[model samples]
Target: MCGIVGFSGKESKEILKRMNDEIFHRGPDEEGFYQDKYVNLASRRLSIIDVLSGKQPIHNETKSIWLVWNGEIYNFKELRNELLKKGHKFYTDHSDSETIVHLYEEYGIDFINKINGMFAIALWDSKNKELILIRDRMGQKPLFYSFVNNEIIFSSEIKGILKYPYYKKEPNFEALNHYFTFKNIPAPFTPFKNIYSLFPGEVLIFDVEKKKKKQFKYWEIDFLKTNNDNIEEITYNIRNLLEDSVKKRMISDVPIGAYLSGGLDSSSVVSIMSKYSNSKIKTFSLGYTTFLEHKNQDIIAARKISNILDTDHYEYFMSPQELIDDLPNVLRSFDAPFSGAISTFFLTKLISKHVKVALSGDGADELFGSYLAPRLSQPLYYFEKIYKKIKSGYQLSNEDKIKLKPFENNIKFLENLYLKSNGNFEKWKYEILLFKDEEKKRLLNNGVFEYDKFNSFDLLKKDVENLKALDPLNRALELEWKTLLPDHVLAFVDFLSMVHSVEVRSPFLDYRLVEYVASLPGNLKIKNGNIKDILKKSLKGILPDKIINRKKEGFVLPVFWWLKNELKSFIFENLNEHELKNSVFNYEYVKFLLDSYYNNKENDFKLAAKIWNIVSFKIWWDLYFK
Candidate 1:
């Protein structure tokens, strides 16, 4: 719920102040700093819990160790009770933040393992001349650090580190190429050459005098095992765990709300939250122009749920032009090229306006096999068998070829084909049309991937094989959890919300909840081609039947229609040949894609993805490098 920054070795007060100032939106309530001979720690406070009592750079009575931390520690109260029993004294009764100094005193580096919350912590051991940085178990919070000339600089956002005097601006092309392949750069590698993000459940320790750093993983998810429990027992356990998770996240001193998408995940959270509150809970929903086109839009279902639950609800509708205008600012906030289309960006912005803290439905899809692709796998499995048998000694017809492409493209499709049964052809076609073959070749040549050293197809195949034990649907969910959830979904939420100084929490992503859901038998998750079966069963009485059985209409935006209408001029202006020629993409390819998309010869959502990536890259480049 806050932004933190610090630098050790050759410190400048001005640099620290600037870093903290840039992220004032994240923590406008209070600011704290600690500077000494070997270390400096600074924090911007959001004042979520213990507003008056909880302060950053807080320390034990003796003041030997200081802490600046972001994120909430859900189990802080329980930890505090244990600490108090062990003779640890406290000045305040805040849940999580207060336990840090005492825990560090009790267990030192081992204290991170004892924490069960989402946090990016920077602790300075003044007496020991050591500094430690820790990211939460699932990377719910971000921590970035760079080693620069006998000094280590770390911050909650890359922009904060950029404020330091000695930081460099070189782009990491390797990560850029990875971004092209995965649509998101993986952890430990960022867009910047030297800057790195601490992976989930990882910790970094630096010794100031020796100028040395080392990192180690503290936790990882094991999907291979399941709890030895019956379906009813598992369901009851899951309900209890989720209820506790939501209740803990609701511990805010300021006003808080829920992002109710009318989907199972968000509704479940809202339902549980309503139970614990004395009055109606506040909820927000984002809708689009496309909702009018569809018979079953999320808003309608959200309204039904809201009426039944009796929560105060707010809804916002966004136009394509507004999204286009906000693109540059949104990308700059991310400090990297993150292409989530535009729904994610606008949705976060809409919610940030109404609530300082909002709970989202991000992790539910990954945990409960809720994606359409996973639900379709059973049908696709039989279809693949029939197609194989009929194709002997004969080439597939043009139509058949198009239908079968997802199966042959790569192993990732095994999961995709099952989950949603939609092929990537539409996206790929748009991408191909956007640029000519020559442009693609040139981009491949200049891109982040080294074609000689690594074959993208082979690498994808290996990743698929690694998940052999998982069914196609489960594998896809796992991949999405590792890559898409962290890189695209979480990144979009973090940047957009933080831009308005709002904090977002996803209870579904609680490690305990994720593990429990993953351990359940797949049948409990999806049945009769329906996703979130177990979740639906659990919410039968709590939520309206209309919502419990509603078809999953994901957060939808009318981007395709907008590109042809309201956004045509805006898209053309930024993606013109002249603009693209000055950058890494080929101008001819960029022009072709725009023309194809406008002409409607093919669906060009994938082309839109590519375009968004370039636009985000350009915006990030201008902000940090220019």
Candidate 2:
């Protein structure tokens, strides 16, 4: 795991070094470079697999294809054997970076499909005179690039791109509007006007001589259902696939551990790891010093599971002051405005103390229909059907009435939304999105309105009607797999974990496991209103009922309580009207959000999310733009 940064022009090497220095935390072990007239590539090395001689930019035997990549190629050993059989020679003892150049030489760009790992790669093809930038199938690693000043600047983090001599700080107002909808700006768009984030599974090939570029998506989960409908068989296959994924991600030369939150996803991964390893597995978790409304059951549950699995365990309790002190670094980590799970920064900091690499159960919820959006998708589908029936003069059945009982307020909210919004409200998007376009009109200042003609709804509206063949639940899940997982959750995870120079690998994010989960019937995933029904069933015997049946409490924080007490002054101080009047938001709307939540008792967590997104954006804007 490392951070890669460089440009493709005859600028001073000092600028490249400055860009590389920005991400020293990503690769503190060493730094390597490949500078030439056509392109200059640099990597900050974390030294995961082959520490001594694995320094990159690893090149082909002819030195024609030089590669600087960030991530672990879990199947590099197997790939190396295949390459060796074909008469490919390697320079390092057993480095994944070396395997990449050899594979590119043999199979060309198709090698990306053959490799199984999380990575963001920048390869200079000297013979072809092109710079190839690739992001992994899951966006476990980040890659940002820009076309400016007759060159292309790319980096593992956007801060590296900012170190360029001629780069300006114009805001992507379209992305700022979209940022209000999600915790982070969705990919293909960043907060910068010129710079862009490469979408997951996307590859950008740039011709250095011509200064032209082309991008293609090599992988995507279609959420296409397979005809395999046997629940028992599907569950059995899930277990096997998860076990194999866990074993593959455990390939590391340095000390490794697992982030055990005691939820089903983490517990399942930890239990499987213990079975595969001969020694005690190291597990890490975190909790709060105290909570008012929110619960901190994760520490308690993690301790119980550690005893049950007989593993070495570590736990940390965080004070509010620590979070406040590190808030600036947290905002800086994501490289944009972000609002969810700031406490994860602390968890990764704790894990980095004991291990160089840590395995997490991050992708399971996004893969299975377990998140709040997916949970609502099932009932919302039924509600929409029932509403259409009533509009057509059909009488509702007792079963239909029973289902609607739990969602009466949800129905009213959508009804109010219809009169307020531009036109329609999709099942899950309207409810789950942090803020709608309609709300943006009232919340954003005239500056955002003046910088118009861009559609914020595009984020939610992409491919909605096109995937009509799949069930409503599957469609919602697939949209999240595309947007929420990669753009928001995984991006946040990668940035925060890499801050402490710790590598976070997720077994659930393995593309093989993702493809299999996508193939199964959607009903099996969220059956009878139960989220991840299939996953919980598959682990019935392996995990005790207490663990399996536990509610999903991810590295959660007490945002609602903090807003009222601990972080109250910090929120208002950072969200200064002086800052808001000059920025994109309306100061009145901002004050209304704060006063309603903090003073007038509108204490819904959703409102708190809105307040934080705006506040976080202000902090980020002040840091970068000022």
**Candidate 2: stretches off by over 4 Å:** 292-294, 388-428, 448-451, 463-469, 576-581
In terms of lDDT, the poorest run of 10 residues in model 2 is 416-425
Model-by-model lDDT, in order? 0.73, 0.83
lDDT value, residue 598 of candidate 2 = 75
What are the per-residue Cα lDDT tens digits for candidate 1 across 1-626?
Answer: 78999999866788889988977877988999999889888999988888878888888878888889899887888889989999999988674787988998998788887776789999888887889999887777889999888899999888888888788778777666566556567677788889999987888999999889889988766566666887678778878888888888888777888888888889999999999987778898887654454524678888888998899998877877678777778777777876654465676666666678888777787777754445544435544555444546444455444434334344344534433423332232122223233334555435432433433334344544555225545665665566566666777667677778788888888887877777666656765456787877766677778777877777656665556667767767777767665566666756666666667766567666666556666566566655
lDDT of 2 by residue, 370-430 (tens): 7776776656666655666666877667676555434544666534443454223353466
Instruction: List TM-scores for all candidates, in order.
Output: 0.88, 0.94
Top-TM-score candidate index: 2
- lDDT score, candidate 1: 0.73
